[model samples]
Target: MDIALINPFLAAAKHVLKTMAGVDVRPGKPFLKKDDLAKGDVSAIIGITGVASGSMALVFTEKCILGIVSSLLGESYPKINDDVRDAVGELTNMICGDGRRRLAADGFSLQAGVPTIVSGKDHSIRHFADGPRLAVPFETDHGAFMVEVAFGKPH
Candidate 1:
């Protein structure tokens, strides 16, 4: 995979979190995923095709996502209900859209599909493609989260 592709996601994620959720996210070092099991409690996944044939997953702990929804809506949600799920979907879409826009600017035109959210203890994710998956972890004041991506860069 081209290393350049990951920068868009990192930049977009930081921007989205600070703008939408009023949370500041600090990115950790990027690494390759070593297992299928996810580290977070909830995840929003969006498929990416065209120049990038794969998917992007935004994974968050229960506390982190709930905090995000609460900050976004100006309310408190103690559990992961429908409202919280909807907000996760919206967050996934926003991050994906922002990253895709940057990819377009760099000539990687990708079409993103609808985001699907799944939450449960240890509910794992299998990436869409047969390529190396990159995991970028982020830390916030409230909690930590990460984005995992498996995309085959255009030759």
Candidate 2:
């Protein structure tokens, strides 16, 4: 994976967590996984298209998703609701927006598409393009989560 692309993702994740959730996050050692990249059974996946073609996914366990929603709302989210799902979708959107901006600054202009939330167990997301897919793990006070990015030039 290009450090250029991966660095922005790490930065965006850190920035989003701190600004939106009031949580400090540290990135873990990043590695590539060809296996299904989805987390647990449910994942909130969002894609960005334009000057660049790729997708970004926010994968979390049920508990982790609720914790994130609670932190963002400054209230306890004991159970997942429409508000919680919307919050997760919007949060992923922001991360993708930040990433698009960073990429543009680096001479890669892009536009983000709508984020889709997928819920299921043992389901994996597949990116079948001939480009690098980076999986970055982040640790926060609430828990750990992952951000996955995959991109390549159009054939």
Stretches > 4 Å off in candidate 1: 153-155
RMSD of each: 2.1, 2.1
lDDT of 1 at 107: 93
lDDT of 1 by residue, 1-155 (tens): 78777789888999998998889999999899989888998898888888668889999899998888889999999988989888888998999899989989999888989999998989898778878899999998878899998877422
Cα lDDT of model 2 by residue, 41-68, tens digit: 3466676677667777877777777777
List TM-score per model, in order. 0.95, 0.87
The global Cα lDDT (0 to 1) of model 2 is 0.74
Q: Candidate 1 — which pairs collide?
A: none
Report the poorest 10 consecutive residues by lDDT, candidate 1. 146-155
